[model samples]
Target chain A: MVIPITTGKGRSSRMHEFWEALTDPHVDFLRIALLMGLLASLAFGMTGSLVVVKRISYVAGAISHAVLGGIGAALYLQTVHGLEWMHPLLGALLAALLAAVIIAWIRNNGFQREDSVIGAVWAGGMATGLVFISKTPGFVDPMSYLFGNILILSRTDLYLVSILDLLLLGILFVQYNRLQALCFDEEQARLRGIRVGWYYTLLLCLIACTVVLLVSVVGIVLVVALLTIPAAMAGQHVRSLGAMMALSSLLTLFFVSLGIVIGFLGDWPAGPAIILVAGVAYLLQSLLKRVAA
Target chain B: MSEPAVIDCTEITVRYGPVTVLDKVSFVVPERRTLCIVGPNGGGKSTLLKVLLGLVRPQSGTVRVLGREPRQARMRVGYMPQYVQIDPLFPIDVEGIVRMGRLKGRGLGFYTREDRMATRQALEEVGLWEQRREAYINLSGGMKQRVLIARALVNNPELLLLDEPTAMVDAHIEARLLEKLKELHNRMTILLVSHDATFVSGLVDEVLCVNRTAEIHPVERVRDKSVTRLYGEPVQHVVHGHTHHHGEGEEQPDA
Candidate 1:
């Protein structure tokens, strides 16, 4: 019920209303959502390109969910123990980074059951979150964190996302070749005196940070789809990693805006709507490719 | 006068858990020499190559390339692994693949003007210069293998290591490719690991037979019996276009 639905409003009128609100300077909430959506899309494009090229979508998923444990712990500490210093976002960031580093370490060290370890971490994180949530004194609505409500996004959240997006761009810009080499042939990269372990851990940590930023808008469950689908679609049409990132960012922006409009008129959840739009696009693209072939 | 060794190893031992993949192996390759390493599948051929490239750390051996540690000389060495199938869906052109060879230092973005020139030169060497802009996924199998070689060559290293370069190439292409390799051999030191002796017959100056251990001898000293003994199985060697098969008990030429 966050976005009000009208009985007789047509799609074109709704779009006009949306356009007016977007251009209006006084409509700060809508503006905040727009900025957050654009910044989040940028992060999604950069990290999604790495995730798909390096074939680590599942690890990105585990990191996204593992951040929930941090959120739950922060809430429990602040509410039940009266810890004023601990914040949920901080907790989420720390947990996400730790989970990413641990999973990447396990993989690089040649663990016998790396996937099983990822699964364990994934489930363990969710379980820990559930436990903390149960122990907290107040009744907290889980729906907001599980399926995102962009209406709740604050100006501070927009600033935080912008900072994270800047960090991703800076690091990716500086280490583009090294990262590309790692994705193409890790063994060759290692032979070239590039520390495969160091860069791999860095890549995962970047994914972790991006996941934390994404969870604020899409929640834990749906961020992976948002991260991957646009990149995969762009991959089919582009010839380089850089092109994929650029094109996917535009595609992600389109999906996010479309989903926001749909959610507004239908009074539905925005995150899932955005994912559905992307998923349907992927399916259609695949079918069209098969037909053309 | 003796040329300094481009590669020198002393008592190198590599182990994976309880399995000793390479056992106290030692060898030397002088500068500008073409050395071919012939061994069985499990006889530590690729492992030896890894040791030379510093990809695998030996428990006890000291390795030096160009009078420096293998790790330090990595930038000066170029390598092509055995036919590793790149995902056909990978979205990179042939030039992009070869440009990876020029990735020597930490760079932030796209290739430079010099890097592009080197990539073009490498592609032309392999006779695939015109196809530089073609998607790597669209190339034929033989073309892909050649593309990998061009990638290894783009860096213009003083020493090149190739593992089974012609493993998947067609018979006719393999012969022409070996001829091309012989031309490249005059300019740089080359270390190659291959099981197809017929293809490498005249291209190699020396053959190092490895079977958990290693021994170096001139190419003329390698007979069908020596290969069979190294492999511990029957080996067929083509001499003067005739296949000569040898068994384990067959007499080996001078050791």
Candidate 2:
């Protein structure tokens, strides 16, 4: 039940009902959304910061969109052949990783322009997914994949997100300094004996996995906005990458939590609401800075 | 016994698609000696530096640095690129940029005490210690070049490679930087690419004039005529009063 605002005794009762709805163990949807929001902040904060700083948001967008191909393939196999072990998320991870590798290779080795390569993969991936989904012989809501319904998340999705989040966090923690060098000057990073090629590939691969995990929360279409907006805001005010990451994560938490609550109350899509909140926050921050100046 | 050449390249040729950048070029820098590579834009000066760094593989060449392939000796070589293209909005301070030099040997760990000390000494040497906490992207162009120099210096490399270190600095700062390089030259081998022929004349032991091909000339032999020959056009040397000043005296080539 959506909470209703009132000025009298009815307000108090509605507040109690809202609290009960959140606390009720049987109504796990809100709890899942809350957990997803927290995890999204932690994951996107780090990933988004790197994505923006390295100027690879376009690459990330390509990988994220490419995951749908895998999702569709997995669904087709599972539904048609009764392959119970083939999870859609697994398919998505593989698809994203493959797309990241291909995109990076094209950007590095191909003489052609990078945007053209990314553009081709971007549309090709979605078309591939659509073709597979159409042939699945049953009613599968594309909205769930294209525009994520966080309220419908299963425990499995949370597990997948958590495992991937830990992997991302672990990789970042281990290679923080190397990443800093890579981000600063890749040529110098190479002279410093850091394998620039390997690290770049690893980073893109990590982005691929991160995109796959985020698809269930923000969907494929809005994930880039969710990934970049908070981190971009934090980058303006912070002096170190570590500080930027911490601040971005906190901002993500604020935007995601507020957006989830607003979406629940106002009956709107949570992902778009979260991105809208972040965009508005960024605008407000810029305006405040301009005014102060 | 004399030390082997720090850098030894024999018949090096580099090509990018249809264009041949460095055509069958050869040069060597003796140990503890400084060499200045003079050439016009797109004359493969930067490409030469990349080859030495093993960043660019030559189409045909044999390159040896400190008795090994350039790639093998890359860890022991400190390279400062021509242009510092770091985004102005990047969130990195001076100390952080300087600390990146120490990231060579260590893998996936925090900076060590030695790393910190090296960063401090490098920053202090460049007179940027007070501004160590300042953002690198906000620094003046000269200051930014010095910061990059400090990054190169932090590693205590056997061979220091600088690409147009003085290109962005003013005349006064260029003079000071030259003095610093003179002092630094006594300790390690330096190979720098410069657009200004006269800036490093007194400082460099020898001059390697690079066009599409290459030639090693004695400091005295590198006159205004040589620069005209190098760029294939009369050079309007900026900053210095002399039209072509290749270090005041006649220092004979030992190449």
User: i-RMS values of the candidates, in order?
Assistant: 2.2, 1.6
Question: Comparing chain B with the reference, what is the TM-score for each candidate?
Answer: 0.92, 0.91
Calculate each model's fnat, 2 decimals: 0.45, 0.73
Taking the candidates one at a time, how many backbone clashes does each contain? 0, 2
Per-model TM-score versus the true fold: 0.91, 0.91
Backbone clash pairs for candidate 1 read none
For model 1, the chain A TM-score is: 0.94
Q: How accurately is candidate 1 docked according to DockQ?
A: 0.47
Q: In order, what lDDT does every prediction score?
A: 0.83, 0.83
DockQ of each: 0.47, 0.60
Tell me the tens digit of each residue's lDDT in model 2 across A1-293: 12233334454565565577689988787788889888878888898899888988888888888888988988999999998888888888888999888887776676678899899888888988888889998888777788676777878878887887899889888898888778778888888788777778888998888888888777898889888999999998877999888889899999988887766665578878887899999999999999999
Angstrom error at residue B238, model 1: 10
lDDT of 1 by residue, B1-255 (tens): 988999998999989889998888898899899988888888899888888888888998899988898888888888988656466666778888888888764545467899889999999999999998888768887788888889888888889999988776677778777887988899899999887765786778898888899999798788766777788778765433555566645544322
